[model samples]
Target: MKVRAATEADLPAILAIYNHAVVHSTCTADYQPQTLAQRRQWFDVRVQAKLPVLVAVGEGGVVAGWASLNPFKERAGYRFTVENSVYIHPERRGQGIGKLLLEPLIAEARALGMHVIIAGIDSENAASIRLHERFGFRNVGHLPQVIYKFDRWLDVVYLQLSM
Candidate 1:
C-alpha cells in the first residue's frame, strides 16, 4: 500500500466509503447518503481553506482509506484546532490502513501550526477509540445523546492529541 495526498480523482471512492459509513454506521452522523456533488463541494471547501486530505491506496489502485484535517469551527479563535476524520473500507479494517492514513494528517496539521487535533467518535466505537488512543489521543470529553441515528440516541466522545 502507498499513502499520498488526495486529489479530485479520489472523490468517488472517498464518497463511497463515506456514504457507506453514513448509511450503515454511526461513525458519521449524516443521515442521508451524500451525493457526489455534495462530496465535491466538500472537497472544494477543504481546498479553499488550504487543509489536507489524504488517501491510502492499496493493490489494484483502490482507495482503501482516507483522512482529513478540517476546521473545528468557523470562529477565528478555533483556527488553531482541527477536527479529524478517518474512514477505511469495511473489508480492509484491522490492517493498519487507518493508522497510515491518520498519522501523517496529524503531522501535517502540526506542521501547519495547529495546536490540537480532535477526533469526535461515536462513543460505542471501540476500534476508533483504540486507534486514536494508540496515537496519543486522550478522551477529553463526552456528549451524551448528541445525535439520534438508527432510531437510537448516540453519544459522542471527543478525543484530543495536542501537538
Candidate 2:
C-alpha cells in the first residue's frame, strides 16, 4: 500500500467511500449522498485552504482509504485548530488503513503549525474512539442525542490532540 497526497483523479473514489458512510453509518451527519459536483467543491475548498488530503492506495492503485484536515472553526482565533476526518472503505476495515491514514495527518498538522487537532466521532464507534486514543487523542466532550440519523438519535464524542 502507498500513502500520498490525493489528486483530481482520486476524488470519485473518495466520494464513493464518503457516500457509503453517509448511507450506511452515522459517522457523518450528512443524511444524503452528495453529488460529484458537491464533492468537487469540497475538494476545491480544501485545496484553497492549503490543507492536506491524503489517500491510501493499494494494489491496482485502488483507494483503500482517505483522510483530511479541516478548519475547526471559521473565526480567526480558531485558525490554529483543525478537525480531522478519516474514512476507510468498508471492505478494507480492520486492516490498519485508518491508522495509516491518520498517522500522516498528524504529521501534516504539525507541519502546518496547527496547535490542536479535533475529531468529532460517533459515540458508539468504539473502534474509531480507540484509534484516536491510540494516537494520544483524549475524549474532551460528549454530546448525547445530538444527531438524528438512521431513525434514531446518535451521540457525538469530541476527541482532541494538542501539539
TM-score of each: 0.98, 0.99
| Top lDDT prediction, candidate number | 2
Lowest summed lDDT across 10 adjacent residues in model 1 is found at: 101-110
Cα miss at 49, model 2 (Å)?
Answer: 0.6
RMSD of each: 0.7, 0.6
Over 4 Å off, model 2 = none
lDDT of 1 by residue, 45-82 (tens): 89999899999998899999999989899998999999
Superposed by TM-score, candidate 2 places the C-alpha of residue 34 at a distance from the truth, in angstroms, of 0.6
Q: Output the lDDT of residue 89, model 1.
A: 95
Candidate 2 per-residue lDDT, tens place, 14-61, comes to 999999999999999999999989989989989999999999999999
What C-alpha lDDT does candidate 2 achieve relative to the native structure?
0.95
Residue pairs in clash, model 2: none
